[model samples]
Target: MMKIDLQKEFNDYTQNLNKASKDQHINTAITRAVKAYRSTVAESLERFPHTPEMAAEVREIKTQAMANNSELLAQAMASVERNKGKAFYARDRQQALEIAAGIIGTGKTVVKGKSMLGEELHLREYLEEKGNEVWETDLGEFILQLKKDRPMHILSPAIHVPREQVAEIFSKFFNKDVPPEIAEEVGVVREFLREKYFSAHVGISGANVVAADTGAMVIIENEGNVRLASGAPPVHIVMVGIEKIVPTFQEAMKTAEVTWRYAQYGVPGYVNIVSGPSKTGDIEKVTTYGAHGPKEFYVIFVDNGRSEMAKDEKFSQALHCLRCGGCMYECPVFQVTAGHFGHTYLSGIGAVWTAFVSGGLEKAAPLVYTCLRCGRCMERCPMQINVPAMIGELRNRIVNGAAQGEEPLPQVAHS
Candidate 1:
């Protein structure tokens, strides 16, 4: 693991923010992407006129679902077992990694779908250290993997990488001459990952939403890679945050719809739902597992400070995030600094999340203060989380310290 110096991180973030503000290449790219995202979301909202009502219903469903989080989790585990799938609950990051490693044992080749939970756990690095070859199959994630860079945007992981840089990276990766055209670059990636998809012995992913009643895991993606990654392998493993659970399949589908809508898609290209291992009853009136898709299915629900966050009513709303990433595009500070003004997560919402999940005020100190309290993020948020208000609360906590006897560990933010 890389050693973290909190003071250094804060200073470097400030320097990067200053540098990003002056870099035309980066500023232009971010502006173009943010503008295009707004236009797409606007058009999609028009097409899906009932989105507001659906959003309201999903909000209530998520709130109620989270209120009974423990019960819902037990039901989900039972439902998964009833469906003949293995389920585990991980209390923290290390345990989550151990559960994933145990499923995809050593000396195996693994193909992974895009998972922010995977990032949170640093699963790829851990697996590689344990003697496994892990390949990220999502187009954006694959590019970031090759570049050895973190995601600049939640929806568009490699949003910071322009086409020219992608072409150069691909050329170096393949050791061949590659054109800078977007289509050509995409073809290069497709041809290379197609073999890995079939050859990998295990596949891993994160669920967008899980149904407690049916143990169904719903994943929405624009690319077809997630289907290939999760289906082709004999053993499929999923790592999801506990907050992703919804009460029923209907509510889960509604949640998925709201997610894609705000993610700038009228309807996602693929909405893959896997209840358990693939089964068929074609011969002798008997059902058989491993008919075509994955034969073994496992899910690990990670807590990792989420339960603690849920205990605080003011901060618990962070768990309601759909990861649609609309708020980042609407954030004025994020529009300028991109991901530099962020910690583990990004933008105004990220500040609150980092404060609770990643660490306390120390980790969030630098980014939280960057929020202008403009309320634009709340306007764009599908869940309508009050980011500005959350930032203010965190700021108060830092200044005043936690209650009567808690440690005062808030790292001071440098201007």
Candidate 2:
């Protein structure tokens, strides 16, 4: 199990975030996330001139939900258990991190929301190896969690460091001389995540869509830290991935208006819509639960192989992807391999979601032949989603390819 070096593992995750790829802060964050996702896909195709006829009606509603994925995932798990939401269907990734660390039990304090399915289910090192003080609150995942480092971009996680090395890792982890300035390292990570977004007690997130006719769980961020990690923690998880569900809410608001114009090239003024937890009864308005927010709102629907790529209609159009990091910065091999464009949902549709949620194409088959099939990721794919002809059609359906036997990727011995 060795061969990983996709550019010396992103130059040792940018030298362990002491941050020095001064190729001008990852080319100024891949030129500001590709000029704000190409001015939000040219202002969402000029304020929706039927974005290529609603991306051919979301590719025929993902061609009849991947042509019947177990009766559309049992009608999206009975519409998230008829809206009370407690679905838990994990088929892998350590049983969805032991059912989200057993519904966040022991001594609380989680607060997440930057989720590449909670960092491919590492889930904050398994809830800090069961001790719990999670906290990622997404300012590029709080500067790659103050330099422990891993997310090099699933929508700008410390896009290979360079706000003067994030003002020198916030002047040596907040020992205080910080002024190299990128809006003062975003006001010292917004004055240290506004006291962990009001004293966290468990509020994870990751659901860019899950509307099965309004079980309603969608979040298309511009950073209100996923509406304060699913609204100020009263226990609000959402891990999501049953191909992020869509049988409605107008096809999950056209997959969150083409996933925020394919990740901020525009149109994001907070499109949140989280239907559950945030109760109020104010003077006989009655029917209450937790007047402020998040009073236990779980929704862990994972299916780790995405039901074998939803019964394979050519890897089920990679489950109609909307994780929209814009086919990883328009993959010229992910603009020359940033975060090695293969794993945690990066380029070539994150090598078809790491060959069906972490296992396929074997060490992701030479990162899916470094995709220069160059359809230019289907001309900034809103839903044009070709992904270099599905990584040459899942590298001919992985018959000893995308590497598990090819070897030669090991490098990093820089002591």
Candidate 3:
């Protein structure tokens, strides 16, 4: 085994954090976003007083789901296959990318919805390297794609980018004058991605939750891009983390509802539940697939160190994250430095995720120490994840070298 030097990693991360703390764009954008998020979430909770109670129930569901993850994963895959869809399990990032590339051959166009799992695997860049033209259909993701920038927030990927910067990005990409108006900015992207949605050979997305009993991919979105992207193409591919699966459809719905409520959406514009490929039995009692949607469907359940995290009692709770991103707004370090405070995942929870999923303890060492441990993030987290406690445990591991035997996953660089 080789010794690792974390001093330079720490120094580089510190420089980036300090630079981001002083960036006017990040400060202004996050300030506005935090204000709006707080107001919206408060009103949403007030409107649906039962949301917190439901969230508590969802927590139990997540706990049980994680405990029985392997069984549920097997059942979910079987259900997908039974429903006329292909199912795959990727033990690591490389295999996950290869499976997707095989499905979508070279020189094909792909339109994709926003997916953090996709980010964890660096899917878009990988597909592009394989000779495919991939277009991000989500508005914020589209902006980041054109600018060649990484996500600044989980739910709102380009939260650090204000409308003015978005206009500049759009103008440069489209070679036309785009105003800083929010509605106009959205209209241009809509017009541009509309063509890609219908013309693309494959469509890809990540699910908010998966129902093991029925093999349903439940996706919650507001932009309507997912509907077009997944429905308009000849092939639809779903790349989701194994942690997203639940035991039953009803439990899945409860989880999805709690997810949206905390995400500042009272009721998301769309909640798509796709079980299998499109089919119809109207022609003389004969069944046929591809009746207005993708003829082929595939689901890749990725386990890039997730199973290891699930088996560890001390850190299993981190897998319960809904990715609603409510906690980031309440995090002091995150509010100031935005995504620069952490890596692929952001903030305190991101630190834990980076250790188990994205990067190893070496990459997570700096982020683990950066946490202020004020407990504000826990108060806002719907799952009530003990981020401060996790940070403390990670620090102990670093000092005692308890993580020495663990193998680090391949690093995926984010801009």
Question: Which of the numbered candidates is closest to the native, going by highest lDDT?
Answer: 3
| lDDT head-to-head 2 vs 3, winner | 3
Q: What is candidate 1's lDDT per residue for 1-415, written digit by digit as tens?
A: 3334567867877898899778776688889998899899899888889998899888898899889999999999999999999999999999999998988889999999998888878889999999999999888899999999888888888888888899999999999988889999999989998999889999999999999999999999988988999999998898899999998999999999999999987888999998899989999969999989999999999998899888887678889999999998988888887887777688888988887777667889888888998889888888888777778778777666655234344322210
Clashing pairs in 2: 36-265, 37-265, 39-265, 40-265, 40-266, 365-402, 365-403
Q: Local error of candidate 3 at 283, Å?
A: 0.9
**175-268 in candidate 2: lDDT tens per residue?**
9899887887788888887788788888888888877766788887776887887888787888888877778888888867767666754677
Compared with the true structure, the alpha-carbon lDDT of candidate 2 equals 0.72
lDDT for residue 112 in candidate 2, whole number 0-100:
84
* Candidate 1 residue spans exceeding 4 A from truth: 1-7, 404-415
Query: lDDT of each structure?
Result: 0.88, 0.72, 0.93
| lDDT (Cα, tens digit) per residue for candidate 3, span 112-194 | 99999999999999999999999999998999999899999998999888888889988998999999999999999989988
Better of 1 and 3 by lDDT: 3
TM-score of each: 0.95, 0.34, 0.96
Question: Which candidate model has the greater TM-score, 1 or 3?
Answer: 3
Clashing pairs in 1: none
